[model samples]
Target: MDIWISKIGYYFLNVGIVLVYGLLLGAFIAKTMARVQGRIGIPIYQPFIDILKTFTKRQAISHGIMFNLGPAFRLAGGLGTLAFIPVIYGNEMFSNFSAAGDLLLVMYFIFFGQLGMALGSGESGHPYAAMGIGRGLAQMTAYEVPFTLAVVAIFIQYDTSSITEIVAAQQGSIWNWTLFTNPLAVIAAMIAFLGMAAYPPFDVAMAPNEIPIGPPTEFHSHFLSMMQMNRAIFAGAKLILFMNLFFGGATGLIELVFKTWAIYMVAILVGAAFPRFRTEQAVRFFLGVPMLIGIASVLYIQYWAQ
Candidate 1:
């Protein structure tokens, strides 16, 4: 019982650290984008303030039980994803509950939150919300093709589905990292990541300027707060996942932050350079070159790289 209690405490601490890092990283991205476009942008503390304000506000409208549960479900998705992934690798306090096959479980948790959000949004009876859900799910499905292929390649290369084992395999030298050892898979995964990050061309599902405002259009107050919090946590968790998979997992907190930040910059720089694509265009793009690259990766790993 005491062991379980200690694990829970460590998990919470891990969550707290990731949450803060994600929020600040998001704010920095916002500010950087604003500067690129010649605007002053928001304060770095804006996200923190927004969370506080939203939580303190009363929910004036209720959209039924599922509607109420949507944000919670999304938050659960983020938390669940983080819970199963080792944070600092080897560090007991930050390792969370990571175990064999956690890579697959993490992927499931990622999908779980989106589906929960979809159910909640569907219950809201908002036409735009429905449209948003459809687009988001469709796009998610399209990208999963290449992403799954990339994972398959990694599994074959390392002979394991456990993320910790994958990270372990990559240790010893920089070239040992998947980024070098399995460049094809990394390329495919990184391309898919552009869609996964939901930036620019792939962001049609919930683009702020779009007519379809997407899932959380009807959410407010504490509901919105939870969603916002989850967004940060989820984003940060993804960055870490990529860092572990391809960048040589960090041995220290500073290294973790730097590597994850670098990985995120790949998406950010791409997003900044491109214009938004229509849903069809985005879907086709992912299914085209990225998909081909992913397949090639699996073939490469199975035939030659091994």
Candidate 2:
């Protein structure tokens, strides 16, 4: 029972960490983008304030049970994904439920929330919602090609499917990180990271002007708040996954913050610099150069790295 309690505590603790840091980093991105465009940004606490206000909203409507349940599904997905990743490598307290799973499980859990959101949005019967889901799924498929190949390369190089084992292999030296050892895989994964982060050139899923808020077009009040919270948590979870897979996993909270924030900033920087891509254009771009790089990385690992 004590063991179970500890696991539950760690789970909530990690979720809290992701929520707080993710919003702060997200707010920082907004501020940085504002500066880039020659405008003073909102306060760093703006995202927190927005979330609070959303929760305080007194009125809401439901399209159906699924629409009402969509946010819950989305939030669950984010938390479940985070639960599988071993944070603060070598620390038992922060390992959460990672002992029960492996890299493959983590990859599959990444889609749980997305699939839930798709079902909920579809039930809303909004044309824009359906359109956004279509684009998002299509884009996901395009990027997953390179991302999957990169992951495969890592699995081949390490000969393990456990994330903890992979992290253990890279310890004691910065050069040991996959970023240096598997540059091609890193390049391919980082390209997919942009789309995963939902940045410009790949943000067709939420083209406000074109789709008027996309999948969550009809969500408001507390439901919107839940989505916002999930956004921050999911973003942080993605950063942690990349940090574990590419950068050496952090040994301390501070290291985790710095590494994850740096990784998150890459997405922000790319988003600020690029213009949006049409859905088809984005798909084609991922399938082109990035896919080729992924394939090359796998081949290099198989025949050359040995």
Top model number, TM-score: 1
TM agreement with the true structure for every prediction: 0.97, 0.96
The regions of model 1 sitting more than 4 angstroms off are none
For residues 1-306, could you state the per-residue lDDT of candidate 1 as single tens digits? Answer: 988899999999989999999999999999998998899999999999999999999655888999999889999999999998888877888888888999999999989999999999999999889998989998999998998999999989999888888888888999899999999899988988898898987898888788557888898889999999999999999889888888878878999999999999999889888999888888899899999999999999999866
RMSD of each: 1.1, 1.3
| Each model's lDDT | 0.91, 0.90
Model 2, stretches more than 4 Å misplaced? none
lDDT digits (tens) for residues 1-306 of candidate 2: 999998899889989988998999989878987998899998999999999999999989789999988889999988888888888899987887775237887788677888889988989899999999999989989998999999999999999887888888889899999999999999999999999998887998997977887899888899999999999989888899999999989999999999998998888778878999989999999999999999999999999999
**Per-residue error (Å), model 1, residue 32:** 2.0
Alpha-carbon error at 45 in model 1, in Å? 1.1
